[model samples]
Target chain A: MILYLMCFALFLVGVYGLLTKRDLIKLILSIAVMGYAVNLFLILFAYKKDAGIPILLEGVVQGSMVDPLPQALVLTSIVIELGTTALLVALAIRLVQKYKTFDITKIRRLFG
Target chain B: MPVETWLYFTLGFMILGSIIALEIKDILSSIVAIGVVGLGVSVAFLFLQAPDLAIVQFLFEIFAMIILVRAFVKKDYHAETPARVNGFLVAISMLVIIAIFVSSISVFKLLPPFGQPLFETAQHYVDHGVRETGAVNLVTAIILDYRAYDTLGEVTVLFTAILGTITILRIRNGKNAGRKGA
Candidate 1:
């Protein structure tokens, strides 16, 4: 309840930053923040009360294991995030070379 | 408290941290904040019992941070002026919309309990997945065999993105080359 609200708020804050911020780096950070918020929401979706670790070992009780699917998805998403960040940074570098300043307002060579 | 409660708390913290990251003004600070957000999300994945996801996320964060840092080092750091907008109204409207959407969804009752037919089906695949698909990882079996076309599309998208990025970043040959050719 409260947790979900918090997540939503966080996501909104990131969105606001991404939309309003002129700095390319801040925009990237906002996007990353949004990604993290979504990931957190997904993980929260899988949680179960009193669920034990998913691993099955000797003498371990059955029927109390947590869901493993979300974890796997999160791992993949993390990798994807890494790739995105790398690409974004590469683009930012190129943009910087073309334009001397990091101020995005001054680097508006591609305005529609 | 139950593990679920703790997980929820962690999620809350992650959300808070992400919000802060987004709002920060400094570029380097924002990058670091984003990295922290990624770490928090990875931790959340661990709590969800997705060890594989956690591992992948950890690796991704490292690569992303490195790339961002490199870019910052290669470029000049400057503060950007804030864009003007009706922030209060937008925030209010967005919050209202989100509240309505979330409340309508009823996520609590959307999915059935664990070990349902879906799990049984997934488990069946896990049991004999390797025999049919020759893949050790059950997730891989589902991804590669069951969703082969989807995977192909994804690969195509990746290739396209790479090509686009390269094209966008291509450097033009200077007047020296032109003079030499003349």
Candidate 2:
């Protein structure tokens, strides 16, 4: 499908950003982009046509219900993303403090 | 025309957007592009009948963008020098590999089809799991009870990461507290 291909292209773009970008902040941003792309791909995999909400109500049953599993998984994944972003921000702050600049080239203290 | 045609077009666009996001020189622009990718993905999820995942992906995508922007405020967004590599070759090779991988999987139908026997077993687990484990969500029941050991290991790994971060961030004074008294 055109939509699936578009999603894949977006994911590849994010990957390219993460791999090619030299700026530390940009690198982090690219990585986040990559994460978003993958998450999107996963969500897209579970879509269905003409499905109603997954929630069950009394006395009225839906003929077709949306899949609920992916939603729960996505919620957990979002929390994980939050944790990762927090750590990334903390690392960026420390990198700035130590190097006095955001340029990745100047911050070569870690390289052997 | 069949709906499949539109789906194919959207898929192509999604792929194009991903490539652009990665290739772009501007970090901020790439971040925005990533957001677009997320939106596209959520829409795809809706089409796939996975509303739950779509909602979660939407929420996480927004959160990630905000975090990236906040971290890079007043910070340099470009690399002074690019890494030395045969870019074209690498890209070509990667594309080939991905094509091969995708084609192989699709051609062979490697993934288990939905509602197969395996899925039935999984469904059974979900149906009876909560009653046995006292967990409300079927997935949660599986994660917390059926495969508890794996969850425990993951928790340990998380704790280790936190500990490492704390240790790295700790400030070392000139004199140790015990030696200061001596």
Highest TM-score against the true fold, candidate: 1
- How much is the lDDT of residue A38 in candidate 1? 78
Per-residue lDDT tens digits of candidate 1, residues B1-182? 64557656776666666666666666667677777777776776666665666777777788778777766844556445556656786677667757865774476345554223134334455445557877655555555686567556656655665665566556443533344210
Kindly list the per-residue Cα lDDT of model 1 for residues A1-112, writing each as its tens digit.
5555566666776777766566778777778777777776666655565665444445755554454455445544555555566567657766766576666777868842
Recovered fraction of real interface contacts per model: 0.36, 0.33
Interface C-alpha root-mean-square deviation, candidates in order: 4.2, 4.8
Best by lDDT: 1
Q: Please give me the DockQ of candidate 2 compared with the native complex.
A: 0.33
CA RMSD per model (angstroms): 5.1, 6.2
* TM-score for each model: 0.72, 0.64
Output the lDDT of residue A24, model 1: 78
Query: Which stretch of 10 consecutive residues in model 2 chain B shows the poorest summed lDDT?
Result: B112-121
Model 2 Cα interface RMS deviation (Å): 4.8
Q: For all candidates, state DockQ relative to the true structure.
A: 0.36, 0.33
What's the C-alpha lDDT at position B87 in model 1? 75
